[model samples]
Target: MPSLEVIDEHIVLDILSSTVRLVGSLLPNNIEVVLHDLRNPECSVVEISSPSITGRKKGDSVISGARRDPAFANLMEFSSEPITYVLNYETQDNAGNPLRSSSAIYRNAQGMPFAALCINADYQQIDKAIALIQQLTASELNPTFKKEQQVIISEPTPDNIDALLQEIIDIAMEQNPGSNRPAIKKANLVAVQRMQERGIFIIKGGVEKAAKALGVSRYTVYNYLDELKAQNEGE
Candidate 1:
């Protein structure tokens, strides 16, 4: 793992905490922010609030009581991956009514995951809102979910570019399965052109930086360029 400066840690924590608060505020429920020390998995820092119900106590730590609960124990285990889990529908609040909760995990630069943001949305209200939206729009509510792909990019080896480009092409195809061959080709061309325009293939830049810019692997970038060169020759 790379050594992260204190400033970097602070920046990451701030961004994540702010994002959780913003999303929570927009929804009709309470939100909880939990920070874990990935380096020391036993320690957890938690914050929660609900203005409509709790008022002015949004940053209070209500998690102290639930920290040792089985639900929380399961949450710690779930933090091992970058995933969102809908824990259970039977979990109850202080009033003894059922509750639903969702959680998402985030990782840091060294690929060490250290935090989770758990949201307790008003399931009844949200369901009603969704139904209302669908009725207002006169359309069935069908949401599309995309799987996130992992593209690994090490320091550029001889095979990096070829691999990266192929992955990009694959993702484009997967995203638009009904797209014609010409459309797929055009999309891949756009991807390659964008990378070039961003100067990712520059001789001195780090592989990770190039990969991030292209939203693919450094290997993918290398592969795409190689394929582009071959296609141009064939033309």
Candidate 2:
């Protein structure tokens, strides 16, 4: 079988290709969708529509601004959990026309983030209408906005079992924020609970990996999983 990385890359490409068309058709021409393949940063933008508005065309290199986004490092670092999406964000084109934007980030099975699908819609007319309405109502609502980039979005794709298990353990422990044994055991339970929720145990030898990462016997992981099941059923 192919590594999950290959499978994930193919799936992500198919998703972006189809989703881009769907979004473009459902929205006005003012809305543009651009897909970037991060591995090929020199020509990062693999697919794009409404090039005239955003000034980005297929085969264009990574934009200077996007090259600076901190989340881009998450592809390699894997320490920070990137957000799924951020809505109602503001940004601008080089010419200073305001833009309302959103984005989704995608990763491979190895937890290597690889692509992004971004939507940028011009908001000049919308801003003008809002200003008029605000003036008419004299409301206290603040219409002030600031420029920002879209958030990164990706599901956790566990590549190496060890790395994936360690990440889950970290997430579980971090939830309550402590290092005590009771805290750690509770976190271990939570970690086991989350692993089951996300189907991490479906992979071959996942139980062994979880046991090693949690510093518990395989029987203990099973007990935690059973405990989680009982708790869920009782609730």
Candidate 3:
């Protein structure tokens, strides 16, 4: 297994950038290598090779995809599974080309993912070639050809960071148990804890957004965080 322990987030980027260059040179033109800084979902694409494959360049934001992708969400939540990478998954590019994809996650000493190296291979041409070869040979078409996985890659960047934060807060409130109850303190605490687990607080202005969603001051949000920290330590 590849070593995943990096001293900090910047070093993780350095390691992934080197990988992008080395792998990019060897891979075919249809394959693209992209490195993401997970700590900053907005403008997370720090490096990319064969950018034309996805129409995503450096400084592209993938917050929408990050929110939707279970692999990314699990990494942020520090899931207990021993997963270091997600392989052979499928997604589509901006132009709707079929992409067979895999992602390798890089983590810090504490096992929190700070970076990801993704390889996206556009295989539409290969599919067409296979079909043509079969037809030319007079072979019967395979009855069970795999269908497209249909993962849509939307526009990377949102209109603004605030919009993304608000969306996250709304999801947290809706999903967490205590958040729906009548007790305001319990509801707010649950909301804050949900945000914490999803790693919202890692982003700039995250605390303020949580405070606004809970109808409290930022300091109150801090207190909630401190309380959550104590609870974790106690456990």
Per-model TM values vs. the true structure? 0.34, 0.45, 0.53
Q: Once model 2 is optimally superposed onto the true structure by TM-score, how far is the C-alpha of residue 227 displaced, in angstroms? A: 51
Per-candidate local distance difference test = 0.46, 0.63, 0.67
- Writing each residue's lDDT as its tens digit, candidate 2 over 172-214 gives 8778677887887899998887666444463345678789888
Order of quality (TM-score) = 3, 2, 1
Candidate 1 lDDT by residue in tens digits, 114-168: 5555554335556667866666565333345333444533222112444444554
The list of candidate 2 runs beyond 4 A from truth reads 1-6, 64-83, 125-235
For candidate 2, list the clashing residue pairs, or say none: none
Error of 3 at 134 (Å): 11
Clashes of each: 9, 0, 0
What TM-score does prediction 3 earn? 0.53
TM-score of 2: 0.45
* lDDT sort, best first: 3, 2, 1
Work out how many backbone clashes candidate 1 has. 9
Instruction: Please write out the lDDT profile of model 3 over residues 1-235, one tens digit for every residue.
Output: 4444425578668977998988899888788898988777677888888877777778876542222244544445563332378787766564445577787777666666668788888887678779767665553466555444455555443444566556655655565545335555665777677566444675556778777766789999999889988988999
State the local distance difference test value for candidate 1: 0.46
The ten-residue window of minimal lDDT in model 1 covers 59-68
